[model samples]
Target: MLDLLVIVILLSLVVMTNRRLAYANETIHAKWLEQNLNRLLAYHTAFSFLFPLLPGDASGYWGFTLQQVTVHSNNMFDYFGLGTPFLLFLDFIPVKVMGLSFLTGNIMYGLLGFCGLRYLFLLYYKSLNLDILVFGVRTVPFLFYLPNLNFWTAGVGKDTLCFFGIACFVYGIQFYRRRIISMALAAALVYFIRPHVAFMMGASLAICVVFSGRMKAIYKILFLALVAAGAAVVYKQVLGYLRIEDLSTKSLSGVASDTAGLLEQGLTGSAVDIQSYPLPLKFFTYLFRPLFFDVHNVLTLVSSFENLAYLVILIKALPNLRRRDIGAMPMWMRTGLLIFLFAMVVFSSSLGNLGIIMRMKNMTMIYLLMYCTWSISRRKAELAARATLTHN
Candidate 1:
């Protein structure tokens, strides 16, 4: 009886929010997609919240494990200790109490992505004079249809962590420029959730800031260094709990072995095997491949052109920059982009993880950077044309 009340309440809430939802080009959130993604998030969040923390050594035997960082001060978070890890807090929480697991994580992820989009649009608005707000407003359709984000972040997975990480990094750039304490705190939350991405994002922003010809290069390096230190601390704590012996040092090539084993089990189609692959890879393959997402090859390439979009837009906008007309750019806009670029260079490590999550590492910044730059440039053009018209 109570279940019915919950459903009715949820439905009414959705109806209320529906009118306010951004609907680019008149596309609506598909029902099947929403429910399926919600289920995935709920399952994981429930699991994360309830599961007890195992001793570091104990996690090594199975697919779920964390390396306890031996080199660390007394720390509050143990989630970093994991190598081939599991969700720390979110995984145990909702799963045990409500049998929720991945679904809750996914929901959080979606909200984070939405927040990221909003932040990026705001930055784009400040950077250039384009219709990015409109473009961003229209981006709703793409985000709604973005199944990978909808399903993964919408559930109890690292994708949402990634979403949060990327979004907060943008805020960090803002803080770095304004010298705000809240921005650093905001980034700390993301690193707490997903340490790997912390460095990746920090580096990228350093590059963006330095190259935009506005920020002091020294501050960019220092800012990135601080974030790196924070990430190392988080990694040390997490590994101290889980037991990651080495990253630059060699471990087993067990990555391929682990993946094969997962596939082997998945082939059985057990009741526990609700979906196909475990996360990291599951989300990537589904997003980039033809068999799953089912878009035309050209459209697929275009849609998947997350990071590459910047190269295209930069080519179109460099002439404008050369003319010394980079209007509305705060000194930090350049810093943010520089850091994002540098992260792609020095920190991203999914390449060696047997291609598991390799593709996702830097992709978050790609779309964010692309749309923001493109919109900013277009807005600048609008302002320029308007000024000329006024003079006439």
Candidate 2:
């Protein structure tokens, strides 16, 4: 436990030191020293390379740490290479070839984020101003604090990619309002990134088009259905083929994931013991638990703080709930919020415990951010429309 605490501290200090540097270098995320610099420049500082690569496994593979590649070193021979286990995918190359290690992987991961966020900002530019970019920037703070993000976003997971797809779908809808031809193509591109999500987005797009109330636009419903069905079919076929390939070729390939193996066993065993523990009965506790969250990497508990932030925003937003009528918000905003909320609730339903809420809270943070961003943007749009009408 002492060693764990020390590692966490090292992580905290590294983040503190590099926090400002990230803004300055714009790419401070790349662990320069870890890259095995063949030729150091006159202005290059050695700490640049070493600091981001320091050992910090509590962060899993993507945390600021050196020798971080070993976190998934076991998977070096998955051979199938169809898709990397979440963490292994990102760490696969950057950590080896370019030495992009911890911070750098995230910066690259953030590029996926940038794609999504940039799309949103461009679409909502009239409402989402420069201040909203700060919100986009803040996801970094949230990302750094999650031990899971190390692997989920940077190492090899699809969360960033998923968000990118969602953002593209939204942008496509807005574009379809004016440029119908491009809508099918934009929607199809997001689908290629993560077909499952793209299918869902396509469904939502269909619904939006159906109710858009423009008789001339009703034909879009068919286009959306064809697109949604096509994307889903492609995704299913690809995933199925990959799984079959894995069984035949990589059957013996996954044997190297020693750590993941142990973790899987421990999870299975503990799940059996869950009912025996007093945890399930401690239900109400986690709802407000983070205040004193200290034991398991307290720094990673930024998720709890994010939840708190959501609640505060909810409190401030209570006034809007007073009118208690559906017509209060714009049609697009209301419909989008409902679909986004549905996706979130469906996603969070899987996490079923308290003491272990640490992992689950990550999902909540993501959903809450999505919700808050939408809410703020919605209000801005409503205000702008009212102003335009008043002036006219």
Candidate 3:
């Protein structure tokens, strides 16, 4: 317990130190926005307490969730990846030592989230190794304080670890570029938590390698072949994790038919049958669904606003799209965007529920936003250059 408390205190201090640095580095509005985001994170943590207890709850209190975690920790490997069990034990420390409940644990997780995001920024800066900032000033804080990202990742669940894992993987990619040791660890961590997400990240990394331009053509082909082989090796395991049964027996049309049937069954009548839809519609549903028209509750309404923001961001990025040549863009930027689009297509095509899609896409949305921000920044620089030339 003392050790856990000490660790928590250390995390708090890290956040405090970084908080000062953020205020110094960011604009007043950005700092204010961050503070409000912190508050919203707290509010969301508090709000989660109101969620109804899971079934078979004997403990009229917070122990129900923890108890389940304890009971299921040992069997976690049988179902999810080893990551779930790992997080369960890690989360259990506070509860066992300090007698903390789910809500309190979530608060601590939120704090950890701040620390993780702070470290991610640090890693990003280190990778850039630049004195002069090249990206938009608002981009860093905006991604850090992204509402849904914080909301979902702040909880004491697999999502939190998954978020951390992605941050770790990205950090590893940025700093350790040639050495994938760190990235492998991050991937392994997330593989335990969510294998499908890990697979997507793996696919994205492969895409990055293809775009890197550092590798010879033969090596690129070889690398892609290896990635395909790896995917083949793990494909069945991923399908099993996804609970997609009998896929081997199904053709593409058969799979689509099954998906349509599942969507029709729906979750509280909230599912959409995207299997019958075209690619564009599927992408729209995945990226921009739960719009104002789809808002049936407070949560969806809040999400609708976020969706609207995505729409606005997409529109802003569209004009600058022509300015970007995929092959000419920096490897990391193009890779991140490709990963996001690939993941979006994968999710939007098969996913049935808006809420689930929103939550799941949290993994890739940061990369998507990063690409959009870069496009916007490039456009601004181009305009500035043009204005100077015009004056001359």
Scored by lDDT, the top model is 3
Clashing pairs in 2: 29-103, 29-104, 32-49, 33-49, 53-65, 53-66, 54-65, 54-66, 55-66, 90-155
lDDT score of residue 347 within candidate 3:
61
Name the weakest run of 10 consecutive residues (lDDT summed) in model 1.
54-63
Model 1 clashing-pair count: 83
Q: Per-residue CA lDDT of candidate 1, range 1-392, in tens?
A: 44344434553554333333323212444453344334433443342333223121212222123333233222224433343233454344333334432323334344545455445444443444443333354332232233333333333344455665565566556655563564665455555554434544555554555565555678767766876676666666744532456433122122223433443442221112213445544333422332313333443343445313334444544544532333345544544544444333322221222122322433354443444555455657777899999999
Candidates' lDDT values, in order?
A: 0.42, 0.41, 0.60
Cα lDDT tens digits, model 3, 294-373, are 88877688888887777777777788776435655555455556657766655666777787777667766766766665
In candidate 2, where is summed lDDT lowest over 10 consecutive residues?
34-43
Candidate 2, residues 1-392, lDDT tens digits: the string is 44345334544554444444334433542354212111111112222233244233323544324342334343445422322233455455555544544544444554444444444433332233222322344322232232332223332234555655555556555545675555555455444443334444555556655655553654765666676677655754645633433322122122212223333432321122222325433332333334334324433365456545555555544553434333433333444554454443332232333323433333224433444554554565567889999999
In model 2, state the lDDT of residue 317.
48
Candidate 1 Cα lDDT to native: 0.42
- Candidate 1 TM-score, C-alpha based: 0.51
Best by TM-score: 3
> Where does candidate 2 stray beyond 4 Å?
1-103, 121-125, 128-156, 177-195, 235-296, 322-339, 353-392
C-alpha TM-scores of all predictions: 0.51, 0.50, 0.71
